[model samples]
Target chain A: MTVPRYTRLIQSLPASVPFVGPEEQERTRGAPFAARLGANENVFGPSPKAIAAMQAETLEIWKYGDPTSFDLRNALAAHMRVQPQNILVGEGIDGLLGYLVRLLISQGDAVVTSDGAYPTFNYHVTGFGGIIHKVPYNGDHEDPAALFAKAKEVEAKLVYLANPDNPMGTWHAGTVIAQALNELPEDCLLLLDEAYVEFAPEGTAAQVDVEDPRIIRMRTFSKAYGMAGARIGYAVGAEGLIRNFDKIRNHFGMNRMAQTGALAALNDQDWLAQTQAKVSQARDRISRIAGDNGLTILPSATNFVAVDCGADGDFARKVLAALVARGIFVRMPFVAPQDRCIRISCGRPEDLDLLAEALPLALAEARK
Target chain B: MTVPRYTRLIQSLPASVPFVGPEEQERTRGAPFAARLGANENVFGPSPKAIAAMQAETLEIWKYGDPTSFDLRNALAAHMRVQPQNILVGEGIDGLLGYLVRLLISQGDAVVTSDGAYPTFNYHVTGFGGIIHKVPYNGDHEDPAALFAKAKEVEAKLVYLANPDNPMGTWHAGTVIAQALNELPEDCLLLLDEAYVEFAPEGTAAQVDVEDPRIIRMRTFSKAYGMAGARIGYAVGAEGLIRNFDKIRNHFGMNRMAQTGALAALNDQDWLAQTQAKVSQARDRISRIAGDNGLTILPSATNFVAVDCGADGDFARKVLAALVARGIFVRMPFVAPQDRCIRISCGRPEDLDLLAEALPLALAEARK
Candidate 1:
């Protein structure tokens, strides 16, 4: 029997997932995780108002969402002080990344990212047949200067930098990123992923002009807004660049509940402030728990902390596996040096108590 | 100020939306549509249980949806009597079509479709730089033989056919479609979009082997399941073809609420029967309305009916515009012959009552 033909690029790609979800892990383990702190999900949950909004929209699920996402875009524009044309909302930052890569990366084009940064971005670049250039992070933070220099050297079509970077939970100030933008190659676009910006300190957002065609900043409701399950995010850039997303995006991809929930979340700044404060307290508690266990925690600007196991990558893997075996879901960096740490998202006190109870046993098991 | 570089194909394409949603028209006119029958959405809404499931999921929106969609996929596999590996759930059939086109259609690859059947499919094909070969619809129904012949003639990589088709709301028997498969080129994959199959008459779904590598059938929760705004759909095909979607699909793209809602929807077969009956009644009412206006209505096996205006395409266009002006939302075909009719969706009696009240005036206005 003849198999259906796939494109040459598709033929070359192995069927794989970038990250196995906690739910998948739970299924394999035959039980739910005791502390669901993996995947960097905000365990504090979405604002009550956002949940109510989504619930209200549940009855109106028959009508397809507005393909243009008009109300949400207008709300975002007003909130961000940019024109609606400057924004493009999609399924999530992951979905928007796919569209951006599809628009700019033809086969054989070069793209750049940190060696162990967001794998989903790398997946998109490679999926579209773009050759990827990897740069190493400086200490725990993404070195923007190194990324820009490499982009110029490689003649890269796109360069990805995530502020308050994942896995390490490190961040650079907004002004630093704005200054680094000057070194960006004129022909290369900077894909500044700010998925975690909502949890970072003041001035964490890049100060680049909204009309700057050289950069597109992506923000998500998946993090601090606590709507990761809703799968909603938006990209902000020059109108020319933003409008190009229309050429390839699934125009009706946004769920109706997501659109409504995000708008309500955006409107509730008080809830955002309260959530941030709670995350901050949880981060302190996690740091304390790490210190108590004789482990060092990386200073985190986001909701997650990378606790140094004070050993090599192999030891860190054992610790991560042991934690999972103990029904605590925590992930770690995939590359070396960074892989010496285990990444843990901040959770409520009760959840953290479970983590605190599991960590010592996990460490002892790894040592044995 | 240097502009970001878009790929050559992207540069060649104009930024356009596949469909102008009813919401956009409402924004342009500054008034809500009195009868929203334009987008073929099931106005009866989703099952109450589906709504409850979605609402329950709202509070847990912090966690990302299961990337594998294991629960939903297993549920669908059981419902369809197919293996879990045979099903691939996606954002919607629209998103899946984009992925399918991307998998098979490299630049300049030839694809076949009816001239005016499903513009979104055409959009995806062209977005990936596929060359489209269009065959005219045979009478009101999509001509499967003509499409297969065109596919062979052009050495097309993909051939798209929508059964119980959109806009024209016409369908052929499953046995006829199954027989037409013999004429399809061996190397060309048949993309059978069964988006409306649930509303079609019994024996409408083609009896194809699930292991048939030559075809993939797509179904959606947006139709008889009444969850269009939820944005969930699935494709069933040979295991090999189904596995290829994992190589390119957004692994975490499914919304948690959507996954829960669709599972609830699938479990509620009683709701499905009631919805089908409601749609059949609405179709009869619409047919009677067409008769009252001295118009001929096409025989419909789907939720909508195409009413022939007894004039040319231009007259039909005027009638559609008049209906829109009278606060009734309806659509027509884009190509000739079929464009001589306006498509009206199955709606609640109250919604159709508004349509009934406006049809005579719309006809009078079009004549003027």
Candidate 2:
């Protein structure tokens, strides 16, 4: 059979999805999930003020959002204590990652990331035909030194790290990351993902100067602001680095309500503090529940907590399946060691109550 | 002076914005426009049902949108009379264009479009280092035969065409485009943009078999559906071609409220028809206004009409400037000949009355 023509690179690549959303699983099961902790989405929801702002802007959806995202950028700059020129907002951190990789990785260029760190970054690099040099995570933490060494060894143009990271819910101190910055390859830039940073402790975020071109920090409203459905996120870096996004981005990809909603979300810091307190309380509840069930709870600096299932990857997989069967949706790390644990996002009390009732029964069923 | 490091390509590229938004212009002038007709946004707004749907969804904004966009896809499939597998929803046609380019065009890969076609597509191609080959429009129309010839000449992997096109508001019969498809280069695929199809004559949109891999049709709620800021669009193509987008798209980019809004928008055909009637009346009024001022209005199948100012591109530029100075936001084409005209979007009567009131004085001032 003859194939329709595609570029050599595209032809060589396999068509694969990065993540199977919980919605797809629900569709297949013909049932809605009892608890949605799989995607790390905020259960507390966006601030009421943000919702009101977005609702007010709904009738104005006929107009395009500001291509520059000026209002949102100015608000973000003020909130982050950085100049507006240093901020670049996009569809989300995911969209920003795609742009960042496109800006740096050329065909055949080398890039580095933790072996299982955000697969979407690797997808972008590979889509551009960039060669990937992955360093395995050291223990549960992403080893920045190993990533830096790999970058220098492969002469990589970019490196990726997630602080208060996903999957394993592990974190490295901001000072440790700052120290690691010194060892980064001279020509390589670090893409520091802080998607969960608002839920992280103070100083857990790196203190790199906004003028430093060697690093760009990404943050999202999806977690702390509880506006995942708004698809708003921003990157902060040196002006020169940030400006490059304009050369390639979809100038109008941003939604207008997202701009309005995100601005209101930023303005209502009281709601954010409330969400943080809720997350903190929920985390404790999750830890207690896991401990009572004889599972080991990993230390978490994120909105989610990872629990070691006291078994291998396959047993953990069984537990995950059982949870899903019992109408609880959760996710796990993809690789070894880390795969022995399941990640549960902090949920509302009702959702957590559902999880608490289901976990013991699911574990017992999985053991059987 | 020492400069911080960047990837070689990043250093080689100039920082440029593809579009300067109306908001930015307003901010610079310290005032908003009296009439918002510049960007072709539908001032009449989305269906009340759609707005209500979005407002109701604001409470659910804490949850990440279904990554698969399952319900919206099902609704769109039913509305488009196509199978679910043949459609891929994205963050407007702009986001879909980026993903399609990533799937087909590689570094140095050739691409073709009309000389003054959509700049966002050109931006994406250049961002990927694709070699651009432009075919000038035959008169004001995007000549299909000319586009096919250019694709063959450059051995391009992709060719772009927008029916009921932007900037000029010209269109070709669907039969003409369908006949031209057979002449496309063996390896090339045609990207048919039907963004304004909702306002166009019934026969203007080409009817193609969804199983045909030679072409893909893009549609958006950002036009006649009056939801530009919703950021929702979809492409219909062969299943194999559509599935390839999964490899590169930001799967979770679809906003939750946007999905609800679009579904509601699609279900409200009566509102759409009412919007179309308003658009037609507005277009007629604009033409009459242009005729009153001794300007020739181009026949339009779009919500906007282009009026030839009976002078050179420079004079048209002055006229646009004078109108903007009078708080009338308007835009013109970038190329020669076409640049002698300015495009105005359909707006409410009062907004058009403001345009009417400003045009004569602006013209006299421009002449002086």
Candidate 3:
């Protein structure tokens, strides 16, 4: 049989999923996860209004979504205080990352990110044949200065930084990021992922001029908005850079329900504020639970807490495995030092009670 | 300010939407289209069970979908009588086409499709920097023999054939396609897009081996399944080729509602049969209306009929514009010969009633 011809870059790339979803884990385990905390998905669920909007759209599912995503983008633009031309919505931040990488990274182009940062971004860079330069997290934070210096040194086309970073759940203040942008290489574009910004403190989102061509900031309904499965996200940037996304994106890729759901979610800021408060309370409970178990919880600005297991990566892995075995799903960082901690998303009181009950047993099992 | 450094290929490409959606036309005209038959979307909508399933999923929209798409793929496999390994589900057939083109087509690589076939497929080919070799439609049909000869002539890596083709709504028999496969170049892969096949007559789908390495077939929930807005589709191919999609696909790209919705729709074959019958009746009604208006309707085996305006491409263009102006949405093919006809999607009786009322007036306006 003649083997099908794949592009040389594609042939060289590994067929891998960046993260195995919690549902997949459940299937493998032959049971549903009790807590469902591993993937950093919000457990508070979407706003009731958003759910209603999506349900309303379910009956009209025959028509393709507006390719321009006009209504959603317009709402987002108004909410962000930017022109609609400054925004480009897509399947998710994951999808937008793929498009951005494809637009900027030709084969052998250099890109930079923290070593243990969002692997999906790394996956996209590598999929597009971009050479990835890894910068280690500075004390669990994505060191924007270090990333910029490296980008300048390597002449990298793109540098990725997730504010209120994942796995670690650490963040830099917006003022710090604003200062760091001055050090960014002249030719480099900053891909600022703010997936967790809604859960972060007020000043965590950088005050960038919408016309600044050097950076694009992406936000998603998947995080604090509680609509990850809906897969709606948008990037705000200079019109020149944002318009380039239209050159390559799947124009009709946005789900109709996603557009409607996100618009409703955006309109319901009361639900958002309420969810944030609930997340804050849950974060405290999780921190206290970790402390009660003699574990140190990393200060988190996002929905998840990373607990220091007081040992190395292996011990943390054992704790994570034990938690999964106990039906409490939690994940951990992949690289060293950071890998000594296991990440847990903030959940409802009952869900976190399951975690609280499981943690001590998991720790004991890991120690044994 | 420094210009954003897009890839050389991206720099050369235009920021174009492959299809201007009906929503966009409504935005421009400041009124919705009365008929809504332009994009081949099923006005009958999805199975009520599918809508209910999606509605049930709306409340649980906080979780990301299973990255593996295990359940949906397995269900599709059972429905198609193939192993789960044979299927690869995606955001839509459009999204899958992008992935397929990206896998096989590197810069300047050769690919073949009929000139008036799916524009989105052609857009993907060009976006990947693939050199396109177009074969004109054979008497409004996608001629597999001509396409195969052209593929052989150009040593094309990919040859696209949409069985029960789009825009023209023309099709060839399964036996004819199977025989044409004999002439297919050994090295070229045939991309059989069966988006409209669910509405095609029996004996239309080619009975190829699921393990066949020379061809891959794609189907969608968008057409007869009435889930276009849900944005779900899948491709069945050799395990070897199917596995490569994992190398570059957005792992979490599939919307959670789409997964549940498609599975529900697939299981409700009774609803599908009813839809097919509705579409068949709609096609007949459209043909009769065309006859009354002194237009000629092509013999259709799909959800839409191509009505010859009986003059030329320009006349068809004028007719389409007149229809749009009369609040009746319809489309025409973009290439010659085929462009002389306007494509009207199967719609509800009330929608076709509006079309019936508008046709004579539109024809009169076009003639003037």
Candidate 4:
């Protein structure tokens, strides 16, 4: 029974999914979700023009997308006011993170991320056999100072932070992050995941010079742009760092429609503005619903809100399960304290109305 | 001056493009191609229905595609007459190859392929630290006997073959492959890339036996279907092997529009039949054109034809260069003997007319 050998690292990996879909849970529960509020996907949807462009491009699905993503890159550079060299587009932050991890972290290389930050990033780092050093979150937000300290102590090659972060829906000012960058270990590179940046305050994102090689910023069309299904995201960094992605990226990996749709989405700022207004309105609705249920909603500059359940992690888990049972699809944080809250994505008025209706019943049921 | 420390493997590898794209070449030459025949893309285009489906899906680009790819997989399974559990849909054949290589080939593991079969497959194995053993082509076709012998000798984990192959436009009959499959080492998996199989002669594709663990058949929408840009491909294998991809794949990587376009493409066998007819016509036209130029055209079942210049590889190189210079983009084999032939993809009548007009001038120039 001799079998083909997998690499040592691959062999060591457990065949596990980072998250299960709400759809799968529903099949088990024997019903559909009353409110699709998990996964942090934009419920506001993409602009009509962006959708039209993607739909139109769909007709040409027989062709491979431009390998260089030339047109999209050119458009993005103009929009960002940076050279195309400053950006590298990929299949969402998840794909880019995997490539980056492969590029910098080999077996036993030191990498640092906040405990219970983005699990997918940790998954990539671990998948490559990098030795992960987890620093605890300072309060509910990812702590820049603690991350820098740990990176220096471990002599880490990479450090990760998510501004306007997930699960907790908390953020740090750009100035705070910039200060941390200045104190980073000379050999350490900071991976700034701004997947939710478009939904954050103006100065939440640092204005670091593109020439600075110490930091790479990741942004996504998945958030406010409501194109999560498109799987389009990009990284902005110095030319030296940016060019490294070509060493291993799937050169023709981008979907044709996504490349075209993203370009169109970027150009339609009016739609983005309109979506932002919807998101704002939805956020208020989520907060009000949580308050009505006597739960506390954390301040959020993200598309999702983390509502504190006024209980322990276990108690909050019960509430989340009850919500799922009651046809409300919601998720909570993985770590304690943070897990004392449940996360909900902003959706349509009707979707929030469903959430508002179910939250009270679910909470009462959970308590019983 | 300090930057993040890169992994040893990253440090060892040079940032190299295995194959330069036509677009990049065009950028260098400062003009677009007159006849885009290189890269073996179907210039005849995909089904009108596929295009229409994609266009319709474009409006929903913001929604991430179903991670399970339920509809597409079920449709593909029915098309292949296999259980959906036995199929794994991916970004494309390229992406799937990369994943399989990563899964099976560890550092220094032996893997095998024809010397010039597909560089991208070899690139994936090498990128994952697998040692590649190349068995030269038997005549101008992939040498099945030699491949089995080499795989056995090296105890290779994977062996890759492209039927009705690219660059050479040749194929091995399904019976020949089924015979070789019997000799593969118990743990050695055969990755049969049947990208061009749809256009190949009947009995060229191995009869689907999804339960066969020894071989995985890869198919793509990019080639005969004309949806290369859509980034859709699928692999059919035993359930165990197919399920393993879920352990590590980006669950949300599928683009919604791509799924729609691919589904529609699969359903429209009428368009597929028409495209095959057009490709056959284009192949005949190309061969006749080559014969008029005192060159021999290789017998081709694939959408592309390989024309032998009846001269050295150097002569073929010059003719290719001349064609590129004149804005008729085409490619040749990378190694000797085969390199004496230039590969031309099937295109529309006008596109082939451009090739016909350009071939003589290019040949004459090359002769000079």
lDDT tens digits by residue: candidate 2, A71-112: 889989998899999999998898898888877776798889
lDDT (CA) per prediction = 0.93, 0.89, 0.93, 0.86
TM-score of every candidate: 0.99, 0.97, 0.99, 0.97
Residue range B1-368, candidate 1, lDDT tens digits = 34588889999887778999999899898999999998889999888999999999998899999998999999999988999999999999999999999999988999999988999999999999999999999888899999999999999989999998987988989999999999999888999999999999999999999998999999999989999999999999999999999899999999999999999999999999999999999999999999998988999988888999999999999999999998899999999988999999999999999999999999999999
Each candidate's B-chain TM-score, in sequence, is 0.99, 0.98, 0.99, 0.98
Candidate 1 matches the true fold with a TM-score of 0.99
Model 1 lDDT, full chain set: 0.93
Task: Report the C-alpha lDDT of model 4 over A1-368, residue by residue, as the tens digit.
Answer: 53445566777888887777766777688887777788888877888878888877765565677778888888888877789998999999999999899889888999999888888898888888899999888789898988999999998999999998887889988998888787899889999999998888889988888778788999999988889888999998888888878877888899888888888889899999998888888889989998888888999999989999999988899999988887888888999878889999998999888888888888888799
**Candidate 3 CA-lDDT value:** 0.93
Q: How many backbone clashes does candidate 4 have?
A: 18
Q: Give one digit per residue, the lDDT tens place, for model 1 in A1-368.
A: 35577889999997777989998899899999999888889988888999999999998899999998999999999989999999999999999999999999989999999999999999999999999999999998899999999999999999999998998999999999999988999999999999999899999998878998899999999999999999999999999999889989999888999999999999999999999999999999999999999999999989999999999999999999999999999999999999999999999999999999999999999999
How big is the positional error of residue A199 in model 3, measured in Å on the Cα after superposition? Answer: 1.0
Determine which window of 10 residues in candidate 1 chain A has minimal summed lDDT.
Answer: A1-10
RMSD of each: 0.9, 1.7, 0.9, 1.8
What is the interface root-mean-square deviation of candidate 4? 1.9
Task: Looking only at chain A, give the TM-score of model 3 against the true structure.
Answer: 0.99
